[model samples]
Target: MSYDTDIFNALRHRLMTNGFEHGQKVRAEHLRLEFGCSASTIREVLFRLSTIGLVEFREQRGFRVPEQSRALIHELTHLRVLLEAEGTAMSIRRGGVAWEARLTAAHHQLSHLEMRLQSARDTAPFVDLWFDAERHFHETLISACGSDALRDTHQQIYCRFRQQLMIEDRAFDFISENIRHHQQILDAAMAGDEALTRQKIHDHLARHLITDAQVEPA
Candidate 1:
């Protein structure tokens, strides 16, 4: 638990769950107890997070979560949908029987993990499991798309979006609805229904989240 990169990531993950809200200083003493990190190490990690725009560091106020712009989030999500959809189509066309089998297995695994994680009390471990499963399921479906660069880019954007989602003002109802959407996409993909699969994925991604409840006037 001492000052280590893993500890930094753990703290970052926890902060993410709490909305990564800006303007809340992370005092050295508090971080020392929270992550068991030394002041120097904590400062270094804060510097790194600041570089990524994940944290905002003030000269006199220590650190706080960065405030992300809605416009930026929208742009990233749109690019992700375009890249992922194209990759998925390519994967469907180029993927062989083995690829299909892997995708199916990954989807099954994700479904099982998601169900268990939903009911668990200590949700942290389940959150990690769910993240893994979700990534695996998406990767397996698009692994045969023939471009490692494209896949890597898709993955980076996906990870960033997932981080953004962690900070969004989402309701429990949204979570349940998303789970069902995942199931629908999985079903369509498994059946090799290209048109339906694309349509479902588009619908899943295009569900506007611009409700006033989520947006606050600045």
Candidate 2:
């Protein structure tokens, strides 16, 4: 890959993982230092981000993380629910011992990552680790769903929802509750309890809609 492409991918991944906080602007000079890129390279990356609806660019205003509407959040949440519930159900039906082993391993690694994030001495490091762990945890849950198309769509929805979610201080109150919800879903899936598993999945997405609305600007 070209240097600019590599930088663009890295920046996009960071935004996806950490949720591009509103007003966290990246200037050309800053990008030059951070990615060892020239001004043109930085502009190219910013343009790519804009093309993807991830940010907005304006003269003098620089690049701004776009704010999503409540309606959009609602729509995304429903889509995620549909995708994940079906995927989880399919996995429950088709997944074998290997899937279970993967699930267990993912959970264990996530637990360690969460602990490190919570007790980290530095805030920036905590944020990075938290986002990484969150992604891995969800990826694990849906990994054995057995349909590449389904998994791709599921991940796309997750990345978009998470970008909006990480824009603010979503860590303090709701994260623990979310972890609990995930645990319940995992337990239901592991036990082959399809109904309870689906319910948990629905509830999880419903909660995302509510939380996104609450945190977003009026």
Candidate 3:
């Protein structure tokens, strides 16, 4: 990857993982020194991240991590439910054997990761891996929907909510239940039960929407 792309991805991951505090100032000079790049390159990378809503840019204030709000979380989560439900139903109808195989593989990976996380004495070490697997499993579910626009929109919403999830540190508590939900959704999809699959998706996502603690003053 190019230097700018690498820097962009690293910065994005840090932002999503809460390595930088919410609303933390991200100075171009600071980033330039950290990444060993020119000021222009850092600005370009920050601008790219801003476009994705991971960072915010003010005319005179430069860039900072975007702050989260309960209202914004609810809006994003609601939109995700609508998009994912419709996309999943379309995937169920349009998916071929290859898609099924991919979905099954993704689920298997996620299930195994969840099992490991559950048994481990400390789940903190496995959080990132579990989240990666979880994302893969969900993406696999709708991979065959044949709508780039739908998939892209779903991805953006998913990323935003995932960042919120990481910030709140509540995902660990839901691991077991999350695994069960994914299993149920997979079962419904494999059986070609569109209604059940959509319902499962909605239930699973709705469970993670804004919690009281997330909105409390920071």
Candidate 4:
């Protein structure tokens, strides 16, 4: 990858993983020195990240990590549910044998990873891997929706939601519940039951559409 792309990915990952605090100032000079790149390159990377809602640019304050809020989280969760549920229903109607095969494979991989995570004594490091599988499984479910725009939109919103969820320090119990929910959704989708799939997707996401007061203290 090009240097600029590498810097952009690294910075984006850091922001997603909460390596930088919310609303923390991201000075271009410091990032340039840290990344061993030019100031303009750092600015470019920051601007790209800002476009994705990971960072924000103010009139004179330069860039900073976007602040997290319960309202924002609820909004993102609602939007994700709407897009994913409709996309899943569309995929169910349009998907063929090939899509079914891919969805089944994705579900198998995700289930295996989740089982391993459940048994592991130290699950922290493996959380990211499990999340990868989870993302793959969900994306595969809607891959046959036949709308590039919808898929792209879902991806962006889902990325932001996942980052915000990680910031919330999602509890192990919640993670276990989420795994079960994924299995339920997968089962419904594989059966080509569009109604059940949409319902499952909405029910799964409702857990996240809560206020800060409703979130379990970690």
lDDT of 3 by residue, 1-218 (tens): 79988998798777767688776898999889988889999999889888878788999889987777667778788888898889989998899899899999999999998889878888888878877888888888878999999998888788777676667666668888988899999999999999999999988877657666676857
Q: Of 1 and 4, which scores higher on TM-score?
A: 4
Regarding lDDT, does 1 or 4 come out ahead? 4
What is the C-alpha lDDT profile of model 2 across 1-218, one tens digit per residue?
Answer: 68887987787887766635654776768878877768888889888877755667888878877675666677778888888888878888888888878877777776666566556565575667667776776776678888999897787677667766665435635656666776887799889998898899898667556564476758
lDDT, candidate 4, residue 213? 60
What is candidate 1's CA lDDT for residue 117? Answer: 62
TM-score of each: 0.66, 0.74, 0.91, 0.90
What's the lDDT for all of these models? Answer: 0.70, 0.74, 0.84, 0.84
* TM-score of candidate 3 relative to the true fold: 0.91
Worst 10 residues of 1 by lDDT: 166-175
Q: Write the per-residue lDDT of candidate 4 for residues 44-75, one digit (tens) a residue.
A: 98898888787889987899876788778889
Clashing pairs in 3: none
lDDT of 1 by residue, 1-218 (tens): 54567866776666555544544666767777776657887788777766655567788877876556666567667877788778888888888788888887887887787677666666665666676777788777679889999897786576556656665534333556667877888788768777777777777767543545556755
> Per-residue lDDT for 92 in model 3?
88
Q: For residue 25, what is the lDDT in candidate 2?
A: 74
User: In TM-score terms, which candidate is top?
Assistant: 3
Q: What global local distance difference test value does model 3 have?
A: 0.84
* Winner of 2 and 4 under TM-score: 4
lDDT of 4: 0.84
